[model samples]
Target: MLKFVIPAVALAAAASTPVSALEVTKTATIAAAPDTVWKTIGAFCGIGDWHPVVEKCALSKKGDKEQRTLTLKGGGTLLEEEQARDDKAMSYTYTILEGPLPVSDYKSTIMVAKDGSGSKVTWSGNFKAKGAPDNKAQEAIGGVYEAGLKGLSEKAK
Candidate 1:
């Protein structure tokens, strides 16, 4: 009885602990058609052309699994893999396999949709804080999304 009680109490305490999961979504209105915007940014490795912080992108494939290695301007690399893509929907989903971000289990999607005569682009992600506070991790991801969206808008213009 004592052993069972102790184990149950520990399990309850652990269950009560909060998880550091976070999500971020950022959007931009680009003055271009959805297809045009998608064409500009939709390639798996095209981020290097539109993202200001990305210096280059190296793409690889292994048995139908597509991955990209992004080299940032300040000299860090992020390895990511494409999980899904829909050309008709103008969206793609990807996950970070390794990176210097302040989060782990990171998965993200970028989508473009018709908005009036232009297009609305959304970049969103979900992850858990790693080696950082929740707010700081959120802020970091938000900042990246904001910058990337701005760059995409400029390029799509």
Candidate 2:
């Protein structure tokens, strides 16, 4: 009984511990409307068109899920899986399967909506830092989203 009780107490304590997740959000305003912006960036593999870092993108389907393999400009690759997409909402969500980014269990969403003067595009993600400080990981992902949004906004113009 003593052996089992000790293990049970330790397990309960471990279960009570808390874990924190890092998050980043970046938004941009495009000159076009939501429909036009969605047409430009709504596709699961469309990042190559608006993101400067993505040189090329190829999409594949395994079962019902869609996956995209992005070849980066300088010579790296990222694999992502599309979790959900809604054409009516002009939004899509995806998860990072494998990537060069210093993150793990990363899930992201990209959406376009109507702003006051133009359409707004938002890119946001939640993840856990992997092999890097939380701030460092956040900064890396934040920079990518910022650049991507900037490129998309300019391209839409």
Candidate 3:
């Protein structure tokens, strides 16, 4: 994963006094098959409905693929560009094109695994920031991940 590195002064100007990169992982068990879960997770427009923190996602044209601009209830927008997509591999990667947190080179992948009676969904990402330190950003990102995962799990029921 490529880390988004932000310069200290610029980072402070962007968010607050401190900025740092964040790595987050969140997982949840869904009472659906991997394919069913994937259908929901990969649906760009339906994301906000399942992810509690996201109010909506605005999509724009980007050649053959699409671009996503996610508005979070926390007052920031996430701009992500799809880097790769493979239904056979059941994986896709996205890079943060722009964001308020001074996040750069932000990349993430969602992995699905069959677990007996259900499926496990994992959301993971890596990125860097410029203002504070790495740990703070990590915590914030973790919270985001947890909230999304929890919402998905609830909706999956």
The C-alpha TM-scores of every prediction are 0.87, 0.87, 0.76
Q: Across residues 28-132, which tens digit of lDDT does each residue of candidate 2 receive?
A: 888898888888885899899999899999999989999999999998899999999999999999999998999999999999889976898999999999999
Error of 1 at 140 (Å): 0.7
Clashing pairs in 3: 4-104, 18-131, 18-132, 19-131, 19-132, 20-129, 21-128, 21-129
Best by lDDT: 1
Residue 108 of model 1: what lDDT? 97
Alpha-carbon deviation at 30 in model 2, angstroms: 1.5
Quantify all predictions' global Cα lDDT against the true fold. 0.94, 0.91, 0.74
Model 3: ten consecutive residues of lowest lDDT: 1-10
Residue 21 of model 3: what lDDT?
A: 43
User: For model 3, how does the per-residue alpha-carbon lDDT over 17-125 read when each residue is reduced to its tens digit?
Assistant: 3244457888888898877777777755556778897888988868876678989886989877777777766667777787766455578887667878888988899
Model 2, residue pairs in steric clash: none
Which stretches of candidate 1 lie above 4 Å from their native place? 1-18
